[model samples]
Target: MGTTPQAGGTVAEPITLSTGETVSVPLSTEATVYGAIFSADRPAVDDLLPRGLEPIRATPRRAAVTVLAVEYHRIGDEVMTPYDEFSVMFPAVEAGERSWPFASLATHGASGYVWYLPVTTEPAKALGVDVWGYPKEVAEIDHDDHVAGRRTTVTADGQEVITLDVEAPPAVDQRQEGVSYTVKDGTLLREQLTLDGRLGAWPYSGQATWELGDHPRADRLRDLDLGERALARLRFDGEFVIGAGEPVGTV
Candidate 1:
């Protein structure tokens, strides 16, 4: 594990590989819980925006294709705002490759959502999306104060997939919580995640695997050069807060 990054800046920390080799590098901006989606060959219908693309404005234009939301913590650059939102796009008809999603620790006051809309409603389901909730300063925990539930699907055509559901306790308990991960085939392949604690315990211990048949959006994603990159070889650890999402007491 490495020291946290400074706000709006970078952090160089030592990381250990599975083989126990430790090296230090500037933690990637994408490595945090909050940040933008950086993709290759993103499509731009406007054709006039720089790089053949346009900055995502406040309009609901039909151009977005991926979104991720997470919390970030640090003390750095004064010019930029801390990561509270994230979005990414794919070039029209083009695919993405070797991309990483965002991650990070929640701030005392943080909350928002991320979204990715391909804009076209064809059979291609050529859309990408991610979202994050606000962050709040909360206590930590040890062990599993959270119970895990899962939703598995084997589509009519035999496409198998599973989604995990984790329920956080009413009150947090620090000391017994650690970040846990669900890997595929005992290898580092990005699957699903359920975490305990604030913004520090993630990518915990453990692994889970799965296989999928050809998907409907496969071609489009391939054209865009997205999907199936493999969670293999990718690893991270930290926990984040689900700030502002906790419910009020019952009447």
Candidate 2:
């Protein structure tokens, strides 16, 4: 393991990856996220990726799409205050693990890649873009919790990017957890997350729509040629937390 200089002359813990590589990462931020997931066939979108970042197929070419709204309660950066994030992601696992989604129902440790990450503050954008290499930008985001579940929207310069509505039904106590992947410092990193609250979530078929706006980055969704029909929709109105990302390996 290698060390990265931390604040106050202390060294941050070096994370070990499955391939025996190591890297230092930001470990201070802890958040509770409220989110939903949808899936669809996005062939055009799959072509733009580099090696080892291919979409995990649910069917032949259908991929999972996740829409998330996050709340950061504990963090090291206060300037990124009012820490809220609106994220869209897909499961892009190892090249050979293209069948990852098949095991999603049986395992919770699968990882994916972030398709789009837009936060509410400038400092947050800096960390996301500069440090994490995520395509995060500053945008106007709003949240509403109603009887159905949660509704989240993203807008910039008065133009809407996307809108999400989900429902968390009543049921027995339950929990769902998973990990998302990111490439940081030339090493693959896995972000651990868990959702615990309302267990009975309504599963609906084909529910997400994307209005890719004029924002250069936001509008990139056009390349995906995403079909009008979503694959599935999952509702979650529970407590979710993300742990410090762990190093896994290179792509």
Compared with the true structure, the alpha-carbon lDDT of candidate 2 equals 0.58
Task: State each model's C-alpha RMSD to the native.
Answer: 19.6, 6.9
Q: Best TM-score goes to which candidate?
A: 2
Candidate 2: regions farther than 4 A off: 1-34, 72-80, 98-111, 126-131, 206-212, 237-239, 248-251
Writing each residue's lDDT as its tens digit, candidate 2 over 1-251 gives 46555333445554443333333444344454444445555575476454466676655656656666666664442323546787777766656653555455224222367767888877667665554556777888877777755677788767888766655444555666777766666776667656565444334444434455666655566555555554444444445544455766675
Candidate 1 residue 106 Cα shift, in angstroms, is: 18
Candidate 1: segments with Cα more than 4 A from true spot: 1-39, 44-157, 160-213, 227-233, 244-251
